[model samples]
Target chain A: MSAKPYNLTYPQLGNYDIPIGFLVRKGLGLAYTSPPPMTKQTIELGAKHSPDYVCAPFKCMMGCYIEAMEKGANVIIQTGGTCRLGYYGELHEQILKDLGYDFKIMNLTLAQYGGIMGILGGIKKYAPKRKWSQIAKVIPTVAKMIKSIDKVEDYMRKNMGFEDIPGSFEKIYKHFLSKLRQAETTKDVEELYHLTMRSFSRLPVHKPDDPVRVGIIGEYFTIMDPFSNHEIEKKIAMMGAEVHRWMDLSHSVLSCPDDNALDMLRSYAKYDLKRFPSSIWVDSQRKKIKKYVSEDMGASSVATIAMADHYAASGFDGLVHVKSFGCTPEMDAIPVLHNISADYKIPILYLSYDTQSSDTGIETRAEAFYDMISMRKEARQS
Target chain B: MKKAYLGIDIGSISTKGVIIDEEHNILASVYLWTEGNPLGASKKVIQELASQIDLDEWTVVAAGTTGSARKLVGAMCNASIVKNEITAHAVGTTTLHPDVRTILEIGGQDSKIICVEDGVAVDYAMNTLCAAGTGSFLTSQARRLGVDVEEFGKIALGSKNPTPIAARCTVFAESDLVHKIQMGHKKEDIIAGLCNAVANNYLNNIGKGKKILPPIVFQGGVSKNEGVVRAFADSLGEEIIVDENGHLMGCYGAAILAHGSGIEKPFSFDVADMEFVTREVICENCPNHCEIICVYRDGELIDSWGNRCERGVIRS
Candidate 1:
């Protein structure tokens, strides 16, 4: 309508941007640009324009959107979430427009959209040149790419500390990420995943039997984005502990529901892509971890609490709870986390992030935590 | 030759050094103001400690460093073990008071509460993004009160009724203090109120939800203030143990860690005379602009850190 081609972009969240970019370029047949990796300047730029009391993730995404716009992105897509994130789209659009930037926003959670079909229609309206058949063809490949990245990262978090050669795991991980960006087919992704996995296994490691295990759980965004949380998972792992994190695109979106439910959704979508039943999710995950979290506390609270309890029950030596400052959903999960810590007699290190650039305080707390847990483990063994 | 371990704690306000024998008995110790020069302060500390100990009778084997500038001082001293202040405080307090159930420490720029179980730190927390309830706050308040910091405790004890002051933030507390002074509140009462404000702030912030049991050991620079000690005792309704050597605990813990590390690196008092300089370089290669620190000893680059990536690393 504006006589300009659609160049789509989304805020960066770890390397998941790769899959998102792939979907936009290959599925929607639209021009896409991934924002440059987050830097201190980006956060500062974001914080400068954002409201002072908003959580850090909002500032981070605001920064990302501005950066993407600078790279010629004309259409920005913001997905719906169960938190303040649901309202961020309109706010971001308003602020950017006020700043005199001209761009179209595809906000999925805009109440006027009639649900899943309405969401699909919005996408179709924006990507009028592409057929539904062509878009459907890329969905499976996108799913596979996300699962592969999550799998590789999961393994890397658990084994990076013990690599016989320092930086061996990181080196392979970097290579895999580059190869993943070039993948044009599902087979290419599968090959790269397997190759990276094999290289990881082949790398010699000096891990002791029953090494200290630490689980990371908290707000969805800050926990997954390394820069947001100061690469805390890697920091803890490098301190001679195996780190476990379960919040990612793979776990949260792709593989959450059972296969049967997924198949049912697929059949409904195939019936002319007219329906997407939210009830099919059915809170099965909640029923499974009802002891720890009965009612949904909103956003990622249920997932955070359930995973914390699971990690504690499974004999994790420690837990690290990372959240952005003033994150209501994660803040609500603290009392529950305390109970879990008491029940399992495990220590939990609580880290809250703001826009401050210095990490000296974080480093001190992390080091002290590691020392306490390792000492506790040794005392138990003796 | 008798073997001894040396530990140094270079904090923002003060520098502390201690030399201990195999049995954990202190051979010599020194405490001095840091004066915004950790290297210079630590050098003076080392010289004073060396003068107190007979060099011929005891040979220092392992050295350790802790506190804010642990790494900088550790590199200078060739310390075999470098540890954070929390761990050092826990180990030192637990070693001294084996039954210490909780350790409440208020330092120059930060405060922390460590919950101990069976002489081991089970859980701990430090002040985040705030310095309202720490030693520097009290010193600044002391200057405003026109009283010596050393005499603050005695003056506070003389108050029959302590004034209630805001303790949520340093900025807020400063304005509140000025307001109270304008309202003609007794000086002793105001000072006592400031002490109470600190204790309450610490309890609500750093010690929130922490199980503070009996046999609590209060340490750090603030522990020297009887006003704060009294405030804490009144609030927790428990006996707070303040050791004479509490200020030296961090260094003492470092010494113990070095001794237990079982790696002996010979130490000499002569290192104190060598030139130590630290240079901060801001990496311009990336937007992160990480501040890389380079430590030099006698004009030779010995250690460098604070770089977050390969691009920021300076090839000395």
Candidate 2:
């Protein structure tokens, strides 16, 4: 008799599901259930179950998992991060168990720490017949898919304001993303990427001789997800400005292993000085942030400020720093952002997002910020 | 015929309207309480302003709207421009006081600070989330202190040693004020302390890290309070320039924006009595369930909003 097929689901974060769904279906040969698009009810459900002041992303993810469970998702998968997000899988399992959800959890963070061999072993449990060579072959292909996806999106970000037709770019972009979903092989994805790029290039773009350039840097999840920050990038682009976004799944998650290699070496030198001296573990990210902040401000604090400093020096007209409300790491980055803004003579707008329904206040502030930057740009040109 | 421009500022607490000509001369102005009905208050404001001006000699060719309800009133008045309070206030103040560098405005429910450079607003912050040290905070405390809010400012100036109150939460400040009263602090001192607390709170929150350069021109509903003005001057160590027409700046700025929009549309005073209606409908197309709000004039739907996706949008 055939064993039960593993039906898995992961929390929705921007366009990440496309890659994740591919991974589960093609690599593990298992079912990948797509979590429903986030809505008011999703937020409400998440907020109701989550601890007060536990940060917005946590609650939002909780709501996503619960919805996935309802749709026959028997295995919930989540990635780990250095922030509070690292322990989300454990806490979420406990909560779902308490809610009487009969499901297994596969946290990829441990696999991430153990490297490719660990990931192959984890997948072998689900696809018991699959060989290690087959799993190893899919990793590079998935990495390429991620890079191609981000490239298409990056092009859209730079050109959203310049579309000749009101929404011609967005119309074509949706078509492109849909086509991307249909690509089943590396050759298919690479060909589609080139084809979409060529198709997008043909669209008329009426970018002015000099348009305002704005860079956005913030919490990884908030910057990447549209629902969390109220589609701020779109709003800024609508004001006839080119937006330069700093985070991508390829860079943040896929490339992070290489990015943190230098950090790991530094932590090894100061090994025993760690808070958990009894354990044989050292936090690499905590040591890397010492370059920006003398002390560890906790969870991705260094990256947030580093982005601010990098963007300001790049001479972007303005910067928008957004984060989930009650996020301690982003809160710690605020003072440093102020110093960066003042030093570089650049303007910055700090937005702390909660589950607030109205976008009126946010719209007003963005419009004003756009006006200020454009006026400054015009004055410089004159 | 002289072409006049109309500007209306519809705040949560009050509705302000002004009519100005090409020479920047205010021909008519009116301020009235919104009373939770912005449309009605705006209509009343229009009626009052229309009565003050000679309609036969001057025709309003362009109109603008500002403040929290700018969009709602802008749709009602067929305004050429709908500006946020920050832009409206900055434009109005700079036009009146060209060399101004900073603007400290405290409205009924919200307060804002605008740091200006070369007559342009460089940065601005609005405290819409908190009400611990706003105009309404002072007003409610005045009622509890048994001193008329309008006259509270004058009485505050009499105190030599002002009492200290927490400048954080409005609830905490209120409780602290009550405690101070029980502790036998003089009424004038307590009032003076309240003014200082408001100024300090603004500086701490809205004006944080912003270079508060002079000449600082203070405006808005709370700028009418001389005691708060004095408190700001003492704290910043700079003289505060309170415009005589401070409260009407939003309306004036809106009028200026309308004139600059370069789109000429003749506005008639008769729109004040026109019937306007709004309805909310839930779209059943998708699971998103977006509630679309549509505005109608004379039973004809003109505009609608509140759809997250394009499938739910009903374009007129």
Candidate 3:
């Protein structure tokens, strides 16, 4: 007999929700509720229950869980990360239970579960009657799907600022997301990725002969999630500059060198990199980064500094570092980033978001930063 | 006829304005206390600037605005460029002093330092959550000391031996100043010490990690104080260039940017007489309950903001 139909939901981390929901519904035979897109109410609800000092993401997650629970989601799937988010499962579970919401926590603690397959085993346990072969094939497909979703968005970032039509990029992007949700198999997803790329390239663009390229390196959650960072990557692109961001769900899930040939990642670095501070260092700076920050600074924290160093040496005009307020890993990584910024002589703009500051403040800073780099680039060329 | 561009910087403590010609030369300038009403202060500034310029001989082709209430006043004046004070200050300073590498700006409510490389600001740091070393702090201290804040620089200049005051925070500085006064320290010495404290606090916080170099341009309301300028000079071991029009730099920069943007929308001085109204609306269409702000010009809606999503978009 088939197991009871499980109602599941996951936190909003950018538009990855499209692929993630498909993985649950089509891959695992579970019904998923896309909790109302995280709004002011969602954050407020989460902030009310969360501890005063926990990072914004934790509270945001709490709010998402509560909203999903109210909408009849019986199980919550949480993709754990390197920092405090790993332990958020236990605390969030207790908070929800205290509020009397019946749900199962599919907290994929990658370390404790013994890598990706072990987490798959945890998911398999929920539907023991299902055939193992079918579920096993779906795991890699889900990973490929996420990689594909990130790949198309990656290309979109570079040229969205130069779209001939003002809202062309967003229109194509929203359409791609809906098409991605309708994708049934790994083959279908792979086709969608290429098709999306060709469509983006065909769009009318008016890029300058030499565009200003900026690297965005920061905390994983804030960088990946647009709502938290005020759609920063998009905003930067809209300012008539190309943005290169390395942190995303695909990079985190599949490890460095996104198994999918992401053209954007190729120029970033050229090495087989593990999660930790593997040898993906920019040329002639391996020794400095090793000495700049030691191990135990966390993976992304280590990667952020390395990326900054790499992007700086690669002649990028500027770097933007975005982090959620009270993010421990980024807090440790900031000073190191400053040193790299100074040493490389590349301008870096630091943005810390806690949900209270107005969007105009961020926009002003971004506009100023854009002008700085754009001016610097023109001056150098002259 | 020479086309003129107008720029206004409406800060929490003061409203500053400048009307510049096509050459970026300041033709008309005015500074007025905001008195907690930005709209009213901006109107007064417009009237003052309008009177200074021959309206019949010149036309304000475009306008720009900067500072805390840049958007509010930008809407009021139909600004073509609405930029931040940091960028405006950098642009304004660099235009006047091209070789300047460091800019230390302390305004009424906040302090920020911009490090320039090749006439473009590369890095900047603002006092994120501090109010210790700012104009308002010094003004409050001056009020407590029973001295006109305008005379603080002259008095501080007379003191050779400055008293030491703990100015890491306002509360600590207030108590320390009281104690120093009780200890029979001369008034000028204490005033001089307050200047030193302001400079020290700024360098320690906003200027931390920033390489302070020569050709430093100091602009803002705080830069008007000779005592603070001397304090900065002594601390950095370099002369501080305090522009005579430093108070109008933000607005000056805004005006320059408006001219550079090449978007010439005619600005009429009659905005000072026109009625602008704003109202707040609680959007309850969803659970978000976003507080939407609607701007009206002559009883018709012009703009609305504060919604997070398209659902909150007002049909004005």
Instruction: Mark the regions of model 3 whose C-alpha exceeds 4 Å error after superposition.
Output: A1-5, A110-121, A258-288, A294-296, B129-132, B139-197, B288-290, B314-316
Q: In DockQ, how does model 1 score against the reference complex?
A: 0.72
lDDT of 2 by residue, B101-154 (tens): 999999998888888888777777777556768889988999998989898789
> Clashing residue pairs in candidate 3, if any?
none
Which of the two, 1 or 3, has more DockQ?
Answer: 1
lDDT of candidates 1 onward, in order? 0.89, 0.82, 0.83
- The alpha-carbon deviation from the true structure for residue A137 of candidate 1, after best TM-score superposition, in angstroms, is 0.8
Better of 1 and 3 by lDDT: 1
Ranking by lDDT: 1, 3, 2
- Could you tell which candidate, 1 or 2, scores higher by DockQ? 1
The CA lDDT at B154 in model 3 is 89
Q: Candidate 2, B111: how far from true, in Å? A: 2.0
Q: Is candidate 1 or candidate 2 better by TM-score?
A: 1
lDDT of 3 by residue, A53-160 (tens): 888888888988898878878889876655777778889988888887778888777554775568768888776667777666677768877888788788888999
**TM-score of chain A considered alone, across all candidate predictions:** 0.94, 0.87, 0.88
lDDT of 2 at A291: 47
| Ten-residue region with minimum lDDT total, candidate 1 chain A | A271-280
Q: Across residues B1-316, which tens digit of lDDT does each residue of candidate 1 receive?
A: 7999999999999999999999999989999999999999999999999999888889999999999999999999899999999999899889999998999999999999998988888889888877888999999999998999889899999999999999888899999999999999999999999999999999988887687899989999999999999999999999999999999999999999999999899787888889988899999988888999999888999999888898887766
The candidate scoring highest on TM-score is 1
Docking class of 3: medium
